[model samples]
Structures are given as C-alpha cells and as structure tokens.
Target: MIQLPLTPPGQTPLRVMTIAGSDSGGGAGIQADLRTFAMLGVHGLVAVTAVTVQNSMGVKGFHEIPLDVITGQIEAVASDIGVQAAKTGMLASSAIIGAVADTWRRQGMADTVPLVVDPVCASMHGDPLLHPSALDSLKSQLFPLATVVTPNLDEVRLLTGIDVVDSDTQRAAAHALHALGPKWALVKGGHLRASSQSPDLLFDGTDFFEFDTARIDTGHDHGAGDTLAAAIASALANGSTVPDAVAFGKRWVTECLRAAYPLGHGHGPVSALFRLNG
Candidate 1:
C-alpha cells in the first residue's frame, strides 16, 4: 500500500522545484508555478531563467538571466533543501537550455526524480517566449532527460510540424513528441478543438489516455498551463502516479478556471488561490 506523506508528526512537506521565468504581472511563469505548489501542499523552489515584462495584455520584453546565476540557484536548493520533483518552463535561449540540462544531469536529478518539461515556446497571449533558434537545443538537450513533456497545440506544431486540427492529428502530435525520448507526453488540448470538451491527451509511446473536463468559457485562463504542469510536479513529489497526477492537475485547473476573475482590463489569469473561495 502507498503511504501518505502527511503522517502523524515530523513529516516534512514534499519539495518541488520550478526552473522557469519570472512574470512581472504575477499571472504566469514562476508565480503561477509557486502558487500551484503552495495550493497542492508542497514546498516550492525556483531557478528563474528570464525576467519578463508582461501583463494581462501581453509580454513586452524579457531578459534572460545569466547561466551562472541560474546554476547557483539550482545548486543552492538541490544541495541543501533537496527536490523530489522538478518542472521546467520558459527556457528562452539555447545557452540556458544547455546549461540547465547539464546542471540537472550533474545533480543526478535525471535518474533520481521526475522532471516535467513544459515547452513554453509562446506566451498565453501569443507572444513568443523562446528564441526560434533554441528549438533544436531544447529538443536535443532537455527533451531526453524529461520524465514527462507537456506541450500545447502551438508548441506541438512548432516541435512536430503537425497542425493539430482534430483528435487524430492531436494523437499524432503526442506520438511525435513521445518519440523525442520523454517517457510520457501530455499534449494540452486547451487551444485545440478538444478545448470544446476541455480534453488533454497523454501518450506513453504505446497507449493514449484522454482526460477531460467541462470547458469553462473565460479569458482568465492565462496561467492554466503553467498551473497544471506545476501541480503535476507537486503531485508526483507527493507520491501520485503519472496518470493520477495528470488527472488531479486537470481537475485543479478546471476548478481554478471556473473561479477565474478579471485582474486587469484585458484577458486575465486563472485563480490559483481558488481554495480560499470556499
């Protein structure tokens, strides 16, 4: 039987890390990741790769953090605090991707922990987040080390060249990504026709599972992907299997989206703090 992490006493909380960018608007990126971690009852750590000037409207510009600083943050956390699972998002350049991949390997996280990779190529508002030239490096250096790769429709198309117009093409996109060496691939269908039914496809190279929720019509789903990926990492750290983690993450996202609110005049972000509502 699986023992729960929350025991009688002296049990430390599960530790999860996010290797991603910082969003000034606090809607997505590390903000959303940490929010999800806290909500899911885990300790969150961060290694910010970029600092973006963004908001509900769109991303204006971003500055990639130096490789040394990124490594320093990861080492500081991994050596002392220790992470059970980690997730990566918004690796803006090839240099950063290579550096993170190297660091993660050196730390032995590739073999010891579950690493969820969110291929954040573009922002929720359609702003490009990663450099076009860094695409190959992300696929070559990081994808192989990932335990699970999470990509949306645009990212799937960017990585596989398949226009995911329907369920059949969506399956093809997930298989193409699974071919890149990640043990599992989760193709987010929130931006595809599957969004009508709020379905996300999970492919493990052999079989595919579709997890769905009632589609909530709202523009405040800006941080939904980041939140979902982070929640999965948190759940994995807390001892849930990949399928359970994905299902729980989807349910959590649906709840957040259902309670979403307008934070700004433009399209807003989902309410990660929805637990406080009831």
Candidate 2:
C-alpha cells in the first residue's frame, strides 16, 4: 500500500498531476498541462511516459520512458506531494497504460481520485501517439477507472469505431464510450465537418449537456486537447463538479486559442498563458 504525505504548511494549494508524453516544441503534452494548472491556481506534477520529437509541423518520432522510471516518478510525487485530481494523456503503448493502471490501483487512487482521461491517439499533424495494439488495454484497464473521459471526434471514431459526423452520431458515440466505463463522457466536436459551431457533448450516463463556442478560424492550435484536459483536471482539483469543470475548461481553452500567436513556421501552439498587456 502506498502511503501519501500529509499536507505540510500554510494554506494547502490544490494539487494535480499529469501522466503524459513530453512534447519538445512546448505546445502540447506535459508542457500544456503544467501551464494550464498554473493558470488555474493548482500545483502541477508530472510523470512523463514518452518523449516525442515534434514541432509545429509534425511529430518525427518518439522514445518511451522506461517503465521503472515512469513508476518511480508517479510514486515519488504521489507519496510526497500528493494529488487531488489527475489527468492522463498520450500513453504511447499498452505497457505504459497498464503500468499506470497498476500504479493507480496500488496507490489506492482508482476509486477515490478524480481522474480525467484524455484519449489522445495522435498529434495535430496526423502522427500516431498511441500504439494500435494498446487500444484494448486503454479501453479495458484505464477507461473503467476514469471519472470523466474526453475524446475528440477522431478519437471517438478511433475508440468506438463510429464515424462521428453529426449530432446524432456524436451522442451515440458518447453513449458507447460511456458504456465502456467512465462516469461521464465528453465528446469534443471540434473537427466535425461543415459545422459552424464547435459543440462538445457531455453525458453523465443520464443527462446530456452541450457546450458550444463559435468556431474560430485558425490553425495555431497545436496543444488544444492537452490544455483542455489539464484545465478540467485543474478545475476538479479546485473542487468543481464535472459539468462545471468542463465548462471552465472549455471557456479557458477557447480564449487561449483566440489569443494564439504564431510561434513556429508551421502551425503554432494555443496560448495557454495569455499576455497581460496594458
């Protein structure tokens, strides 16, 4: 059994952790998560599962972190700093996913912690981030443990084998994903074809809620998913309900995308931290 550290001095800050890959370009993955946590007034911790060679243009390759190293990071942080809520993104293989699931159960976090699972399958430029063979493990081992599962249209199709092109399909996909285990399912409709509004569908096995924002015309959204998931986890750590957390995350990410500036020659990252100009 893993024993967590007691809260040490002063007013205890909300604590959140991100278990994900490292994006070298600083646009997505752990980088986006940390930025969002700080922006939302949470202390962020990370356990990197892989390192990707990526830029604004694309992901060239990746190297998975050793399982021992991954477990060590998670154990070190969980035992000492502790976590109120956590989020997972871009587990590159079944090995990493299984390790994470085992670690969570071992630490007694599976049922108690608020865990947001972002089913990140690929990069913005069509590079695969997760191994195809790991899909079963993700669905069987990790999905059942998630407090909420966030999947974009592409991921919805990938995970559920349903092409999510319209509202009806989106709802069906959300239900299908919900059946796999999460207490709530949020299907992000950002890439829906010919849609004027980007609508995200949230279903908590009983009720359905839709959150929509005007589709901003921009290509500088390299780390949007990571930012959204991190923001939701941050909100959860700060004691928001699932619906409220999703709403806050959506609003924050929309603003970040709106204020995004070109950083690289190719597509740039959304501004997780907006500028404070006079």
Best by TM-score: 1
Question: Model 1, poorest ten-residue lDDT window?
Answer: 1-10
- Pairs that collide in candidate 2 are none
For model 1, the local distance difference test gives: 0.88
lDDT of candidate 1 over 110-224, digit per residue (tens): 8999999999999977899999999999999999999899998889999999999888898889889999989999988887763568779999988898897778888788888
The residue pairs found clashing in candidate 1 are none
Assess each prediction's global lDDT (C-alpha) against the native: 0.88, 0.89
Cα-lDDT of candidate 2: 0.89
Compute each candidate's TM-score over C-alphas.
Answer: 0.95, 0.94
List runs of model 2 lying over 4 Å from the truth. 1-10, 275-278
For model 1, the stretches where C-alpha displacement exceeds 4 angstroms are 1-11
**What's model 1's lDDT at 3?**
20
